[model samples]
Target: MLLELRDISVNYGKISAIRNISIGVPEGQIVTIIGGNGAGKTTTLRAMSGMLPLQGGEIYFDGKRVDGMAPHKIVAHGIAHVPEGRRIFPDMTVEENLRTGAFLRKDKDKIEADLEDVFNRFPRLRERRRQRAQTMSGGEQQMLAIGRALMSDPRVLLMDEPSMGLAPVIVEEIAVIIEEINQRGLSVVLVEQNAVLALELANYAYVLETGNMALEGPASELHDNEHVRAAYLGL
Candidate 1:
């Protein structure tokens, strides 16, 4: 596995957000966690990114333990998180926000090349390069968020609720972008409420319920599962 969360648990203040949840993402494949609102989907991603301190358990990436590392240090370890709500800097220009993703790196020439690549992938961002991020549409901002994450040249990308609040058409667009990203050699851990879309995109899937592991299997098998169908797919 490129990324592994072994028997992980996390607490928010005194409240346990997730407990004993384990997940794995193999290199070059997408692994998705699907669950309902408040089911600890976001918390799992936060734990991997070191944004939340683990109450118990460990996280490993590229064969190194990283659970207690700082968030920026985790980013330096080649794990980039595109958090929920497309957390771009509202006051920063699109270019500035993209540069912030590369804050840990010193390769100036590669950074500029990566910036151009981001613009190429997100032409709309290129068009609004000088515009404040808050001035863009939600879909555009989401593209900016993904673009920003890509700027880090990460080996693994953790995406939380990438489709949340997006229109159907834009959701489709986001889905395609994710596939393209995975195809280009980045392992992905996706947390999404859209089970059908998530299952379709992932090679493997984990189901979470009330912050605990509920089910797991190859994505195709999970998609056909009667329980997953009834509970998550509404089939």
Candidate 2:
């Protein structure tokens, strides 16, 4: 496994947000966690990126323990998180926001190359490179957020609800970008409430229910599951 969470738990003060959850992401594969709001999907992603401290269990990325590491340090170790909510710096230019993702790196030449690559992947961002991020539409901001994460050149990308608020067309575009990114060999751990899209994109799927692992299997299997169909697919 390239990324593994072993019986990990996260708490908010005295309340546990996630409990003994375990998931794995193999190299070059897209793995997804799907459930309703408050299912601990976002919390799990935060724990993996070191944004939330774990109360128990361990995290290993590329064979090195990373549970206690700082968030920036985790990014340096090749994990980039595109958090929930298009949290781009509103006042900054689109290009500036993208560059900030590489704050921990020192290779100027490679950073520039990565910036160009991001622009190419998101041509809308390139057209608005000099525009403030806040001025862009929701779909454009989502693209900028994803492009920014890719700027870090991470081996594993952790995304939280990349399709939260958008039209169907925009969601389809984001899905294409995600597939393209995975095809380029970056492993992904996606946390999404859109189970239909999640199951379609992921190679493997884990269903979370109020801080616990409810079910898991190959994506195709889950797609055909009765429970998943009733609860998530509206079928």
Candidate 3:
């Protein structure tokens, strides 16, 4: 497995956000977590990225325990998180924001090459390479945030609510980009409230409800589940 969460638990003061939740992602596959509000989907991704410390359980990445590592160290270990809210540097130019993602790397030539590759994958980013990210639309900002994460040349990408607050058309575009990224051999763990799209894109899926894992299976199996259809797909 590329990533594994074993009986992980997270706390917010005295309240538990997640408990005994276990999930695993193999290399070069798209895994998704789907649920409604307050489901702890984002919390799970944060825990794996070391942004939130696990009070119990363990997280292993490439066979190394990584539960309590610092966020920067996690990135150094080849994980990049495109956090919710598209938290790009608002005042920085697109190029500058992308450079920030590569702060730990000292190889300038490789960084430059990766930057060009990101621009190629996201031509709109190249066009706005000099523009401040704050001036861009929500969809564009999301793309920039994703591009910045890619600049780090990560092995596993953690994406939280990538389609949030976008028009349907923009959401579809993000989905296509995710598929394209996976095709290039990067592993992904996507957390979203959009169950339909999540299941459609992912090979494996986990369903969370109020901090507990409710179901786990292949995406195709879950999509055909009566309860999943009724609750998540509204079918």
- Sorted by lDDT (best first), the order is 1, 2, 3
Off by over 4 Å in 1: none
The TM-score of candidate 1 is: 0.98
**Candidate 2 on 1-235: residue-level lDDT in tens?**
9999999999999999999999999999999999998999999999999999999999999999999999989999999999999799999999899999988889999999999899889999999999999999999999999999998889999999999999999999999999999999999998889999999999999999999999999999999999999999999
- For lDDT, the strongest prediction is 1
For candidate 1, the per-residue lDDT at 152 reads: 95
- The sequence of per-residue lDDT tens digits that candidate 1 reaches over residues 1-235 is 9999999999989998999999999999999999998999999999999999999999999999999999989999999999999999999999999999889889999999999988988899999999999999999999999999999999999999999999999999999999999999999999999999999999999999999999999999999999999999999
Pick by lDDT: 1 or 2, better one: 1
Instruction: Single out the weakest 10-residue window by summed lDDT for candidate 2.
Output: 145-154
Better of 2 and 3 by lDDT: 2
lDDT (Cα atoms) of all candidates against the true structure: 0.96, 0.95, 0.94
- Estimate candidate 1's alpha-carbon lDDT, on a 0 to 1 scale: 0.96
Model 1: clashing residue pairs? none
